[model samples]
Target chain A: MGKIRTRLGDGSFIELLEEEIYEDLVDGTQDAAQKGRIPPLSEDELRYLLDLYKSKARVVGVDEGHECCLSYDNMTSKIERAHISVSKFQQLQLFERALGADTLELAHIDYSYKQVKHVVIYDKPNMEQAVLLTIPPMLYGAMPNLGLYTYPDGPCPNPGDLLPQGKFDEAKEAYAQAIELAIKDMIFVGSELYEAGADGINFDTTGAAGDAEFYAALKAAETLKAKYPKMGIEMGMAGEFILGMHGEIEYEGVRLAGLYPHDQVKLAQKAGVTIFGPVVNTGTNESLPWNLARSVTFTKACSEASEIPLHANLGMGVGGVPLNIMPPLDALSRASKAHVELCRLDGL
Target chain B: MHAAHSIASGMGGMRTTGDLVARLQLNKGMRIEQAKQYVADKLKVPVTDLADSVTMGEMREDLNIGVVNEAPGVAKGIDAKFRIAELLDLDINCVDMFKDRVKP
Candidate 1:
């Protein structure tokens, strides 16, 4: 049987089409030619390709069914997965212990200039030090029964809901409590909270007066500060924010802002936010123009411009370095180490 | 002068009582009075049983009986003694008597 041929986004070719699948591709070739390509894949061919990628394209040995995936690559191992069910409190304890037990000192919890020493509790007597703890905003999203109210509608439940309401209030409360505990332990540094996407889920503010969502987020932040007077908040903005802010939109509510890091810094400062970052690891294979260096540069520039701290959510595994790679502990460690160094260099 | 000299020896470089109190908190069930006595006995003077103060003279004389001028060491010893006392359901002061007799 002839093998099936597939092309990846990187332009790399793979032979997955077998002779048995030749009949399925009979019409695929004509479709591809029509589209200015070799041949179009039939629905069956597409499904097969997706299945193959699902099996082979993922990080090897990391089970998706589990709450977390521990994977390894050429440089280091990492842990990544989604839909974790652990409580924020439990996750925080595990994270603290893991950082200490890993014994990698390159990572740190950044709160302005202070590098707080994380306590290692994982192995107890044989504890190791962790260089970094990659906590997702999912923790905040997972609190019990917290719903978010969206405009144009009412309140939405679950994270997938477009317009959410009550969850914001709950998120505020959780963050406030977390900040209080964190400050007492001197572990409060920065945070990675989920931001609403541009999709119609919440508000289409991405194109219109998107500042509305920012304003809402500000209210949430105000609530948090009222509880933890000493806590610092760092909001993680989606990459779409960058793309949306630069492009022209017709909505009166939505304003087009420059893409320069300084502009983001200014926007964050005006919002009374201390830290701002964008998504880095979205499973996209292509490396950005400057890779993570661009993010670092942008964050540093933004910080300097607005005198606000900035963090870069560098995607997992870029080039050979584990910038945003996951599931592999070693990779996570190295990436975290690199981030610490970058933060230090930027005087964060 | 002899009594003062003896007391001074007993009190040799004793740590502040507040420090001892802090150390006691680390031990699960140790009371402030017990912590004070532990410090006094280590100093080798008559255990005044005071919660607030353990005179330096008394601690200096007690230093001769293996009570080095180390706060951490003393604190550790106190912790261990407290743990054992808790485990055995024995009085903390009685543990000291057992230690003295058992050493030959």
Candidate 2:
């Protein structure tokens, strides 16, 4: 039998035997099931993947609704990084006029709220046309970073050094301190941006540093929402499951660690998040069929449970899209289509 | 410059074939030599030609997967992926199923 052409989760082009495809689908579903404790794809859904791969068309599309609007996390910075040499506002204009992005985010290259807190003056001029000021609640980038708490840089003993000595409490104490610092920075930056004529504030890539980071974002969101009732806030998650890096962190009585997208959305709503971007990590070795099925299943549940708009994170290494920095459109379109069609997505 | 080129510039230049070779090595566990050979076979180019940016640039332009230099109004980003899908004969499963369910 001839091999069917397909792409790996990393967006690498490859061909595989029919049996290999089946094996990948099963493995991918089981992987998601084990990790999230969620139901696997139904047999019919699995058959859909098998038939889709066996189809003759190379590139494919939905007959309708592929032209849906998009919302971006770090819109202007991505344009500037591409060496576009345009002003930040012009980059937003380009996305609106050329790329048709419905909503745009104006952000600094540093990309973290702690870093952007010092640069809101520069970002203020770019606030027009439904633009949100975006920044990550990057606990890892905060002052006295975990590294600073350890080693030659600071007076405190190194956590890594302490961990081997069974100083788990010391290591966790350092993380707890970092989370408090990050929350302050996020609230400060978000308030500064909101006051500067911005339409919204996006806490991009929340939970990247795990539960402590997620806690900081939720707390910051709660504070900011109470302060400015009209300011739109979007919390885009870093992964499907919040990592238990600082496993003891809680937001509003619900523990932050190990919460899946469905559960995560509930916390976001309680914290007054206006939009939620739930991510499903892609497996580099799995086929797109497996990845998309897994991502959709998780995101569908998230969308159903979400009170806010569900802007599923459909980008590199997440959302069943390939891990390519410039994700090939085949995967992007297919992933977007599936999320919109199968899941109740507001934007990609 | 085409808008897609502008978008592609920051996201990393049209390194589609090179990216493919690298992913095969990194993800598929192919050795460097094996990955290069595999990419060469799929792309129908000489193995040595893979590293030649000038040659690869033209090949990418021709293939419409993406290009180091922009060809005005041609594919890039999502448009490029459409061409890549057909050129590479990739089965984007969602696309296939959607087409089947919707077609006359």
The global C-alpha lDDT for each of the candidates, from Candidate 1 onward, is: 0.29, 0.63
lDDT per residue (tens digit) for residues A109-133 in model 2: 7777766667766665444222221
Model 2 iRMS (Å) reads 18.7
Q: Which prediction has the highest DockQ against the true structure?
A: 2
Q: Which ranges in model 1 have alpha carbons more than 4 Å from their true place?
A: A1-90, A101-211, A222-228, A240-260, A278-285, A288-290, A315-348, B1-104
| Each candidate's fnat | 0.00, 0.01
How does candidate 2 fare on TM-score?
Answer: 0.69
Report the TM-score measured on chain A for model 1. Answer: 0.38
- Per-residue CA lDDT of candidate 1, range A80-145, in tens? 123365533333333322321100111111211112223222111111111112111111111011
Indicate the docking level reached by candidate 1. incorrect
- Structure candidate 2, residue pairs in collision: A82-B10, A150-A158
